[model samples]
Target: MQSLLKNECSVLVFTLSGLNETMENRYVLFSLTALYYPLIVFCNVTIITTILLHKKLHEPMYVFICNLCVNGLFGTSGFYPKFLYDLLSHDHVISYIGCLIQIFVIYSSILCDFSTLTVMAFDRYVAICRPLEYHSIMTNQTILKCILYCWLAPFFSMCLVISLLSRLTLCGSTIEKLYCEIWAVAKLSCFSTIVNNVFGYIVTLTFFGHAVLIFCSYIYLIRKCRKSIESRQKFMQTCVPHLFSLINVTAAFMFDILYSRYGSKNMLQGVRNFMALEFLLVPPILNPLIYGLNLTIVRQQVMRLLFSRNKCDE
Candidate 1:
């Protein structure tokens, strides 16, 4: 009986040994991880600084941009270092507690991303549909309350999901993806994952569902803007940022769903590496550039900042 138990343990270990090895030689992964932080910091910092320095940008839209910059910075910094370390070391060895922390942070950040985008959509809705009442409706106190709600909603949601994930008894494999994703880790459990799947779908509905509503809201908003012929340029300007944000969010949700549902071994691994680049690198880099290059005020501020720095050096 003891010999049989020992054999079972040995087989389990042997079968799972190469799990992390499949992620090796991913230089693009390494480059992305290394490049992610500096770019995130630079873009987010520039955004926040540009907004703070210019009194003209203290409106609701820019306020939300500042909030987004802070959220993106936290998300990038919180997830990437540990993820990069895990990938390079080929160590799928995360403590159960560590795994829980990782899941909470990741899901919370994702929630923040989605919620902020939704709030930004509402801001556009008000700006386009109810321009006269925009100021009274989007007061500083109201915006602050929205921001607080955005953070809190995700905090509670992720806590519930993390609790459900923790109850799953991991038996088959310890090494999940390059990082600890709740769904991926839950699949390795010995027990049934019916509850996990159910709750996951519910969470997806609540979060991503809100995103869909926001998308529809934008569609209506654009139609309303078109009817208000006087502000056509202003309407398009307001929409460009939201349009980019919408595309990024949709791509992320689709990639995650596909990878979770139908992804095979090689495909899953490839998707994992590329998804980080797709979601993190592209949006952070593009958002600031879009706002900076397209908006005259932002472009002038950035150019002035650069010009001042060069003169100071001389």
Candidate 2:
């Protein structure tokens, strides 16, 4: 009881211990991070720039892909800059408000990815399953609404999460992740986190329902396309990449959640960090590359832009 009272819920700075046992390779880690973060930024920016400039690539599908890349950048920005800084410095601590902000940014971007992918699935459903009504259903106004849903839904979800977290009376200040995470911070609370856990599950189940809808839509699409060779070919060309991305993001999210909640200390620190980071590391780079290589229009425009630039240089 005395020790509990002494905890006081007054910690101003939260210490991160994810790297505490692995500081021997700080320089190598910093060097790799320094190189990798810029690569993520470059790839995402290229996609966004390509989409915005090319009138032909300005379709609803491509626009959603651009938004996914943008969200990737937003999510990485929340972690990489501060992570690189922490690698250089001996101390790794974040202010109370900074932790809240980081949680909001990172998680919201994740949820936004799901929302954007949901839109993409619907776009493909209309395009392949109901070809004639594609344009009428996926109008400029409809695209605008989809964009709003992608950004605004996640923003509102995170706002509620942050508000709830801010009210908690924390009993500790040590976080065991590479960056601020919602569950890690909530675990420090002195009081009952039943409400937080319930709301967190609600959010989890809601986004998961997004995944279920995407999966069901694909089932109908597969059945519909089975009748027509051209439709099958189109599904393979376009929908395959979206399927890959969905699987990739879903796996990463599962790893992070499972490891965060139930990870054993017997496991290697490096392995644990990888689980925590897989989502941020893989999806951001992989999504752009997958789409860029697989999509004929985007790839052709990219090559044209490159060849044109080469000719100019010569």
Candidate 3:
């Protein structure tokens, strides 16, 4: 029995059961995802390219927005290709290493979203609250450090999580969700996952604190802006989009976290699937649109680029 259990613990490939009941609609789903995934890619890519090519749009806020879009592409790439493949393939199995990489990419991207937003909020605060010090404080070096934090913090955090997950002896080989997630993988462990849970909560709380700080800072910004029309306009133009993106991402994360931790098994599979996929679906499409359309400079630059390309084709 002990040897058999040991053999079972050595799970090399994990079966993803998230698509089992939805297989009948595979072709329909595939068609939609095939159409939609590229749109997500294009939108994010356009924003990234627009920001990179135009020197005038290279401010701290635009740079952060560009980073957000890049992270969108990064996160969605981790899920969409595999998901599109699974929509057609009968087997929804992933190798152990592949699963770990997917988790790292997707979750780290999510964390990067929060980190970038935190820095963007700070940029706005300085630009509005202490206008004189804005350029000095948000120097090229500062922006680079902020970008590093956006990526490296999540990378190291997930490294610890994947390490913890790799150490566990998984008793099962099936994951219920559409993609590989830390919690889903951890739940398969044969032993108690108290440490993993603790560490996961620690990360969660730390980011939650970020959200809180951003909110508080924005409130102060709002109060300060009320006295000046220029500040008010800037807040509406820039901060509103950030607020919208924050709300969208926050809601998406909340849904996934709640569903993963406390979702009822009796719930419909479609509902479960949507809850799991909301973050991936909504944010990638939404973030780019929010920034590309809302920021006047980016919008003008994108339009100019499109016109120039068309003229070149002629």
Q: Tell me the tens digit of each residue's lDDT in model 2 across 138-210.
A: 9999999999999999999999999999988789999998899999998998889999999998998899789
Per-residue error for 18 in candidate 1, Å, reads 9.9
Higher-ranked by TM-score: 2 or 3: 3
Output the better candidate (1/2) by TM-score. 2
User: Relative to the true structure, how large is the alpha-carbon lDDT of every model?
Assistant: 0.72, 0.92, 0.92
Taking all chains together, the TM-score of candidate 3 against the true structure is: 0.98
Better of 1 and 3 by TM-score: 3
Query: What is the Cα-based lDDT of residue 202 in candidate 3?
Result: 90
> What TM-score do all the candidates reach, one by one?
0.85, 0.96, 0.98
Against the true structure, candidate 2 reaches a TM-score of: 0.96
Tens digits of lDDT, candidate 1, 12-34 = 32111223545656576678768
Query: How many residue pairs clash in each candidate at the backbone level?
Result: 0, 0, 0
| Candidate 2 residue 245 C-alpha distance from true site, Å | 0.3
Clashing pairs in 2: none
Q: Which ten residues in a row have the lowest lDDT in candidate 3?
A: 1-10
Over the full model, what C-alpha lDDT does candidate 3 score relative to the true structure?
A: 0.92
Off by over 4 Å in 3: none
Give the range of the ten consecutive residues with the poorest summed lDDT in model 2.
1-10
* RMSD after Cα superposition, model 1: 4.0
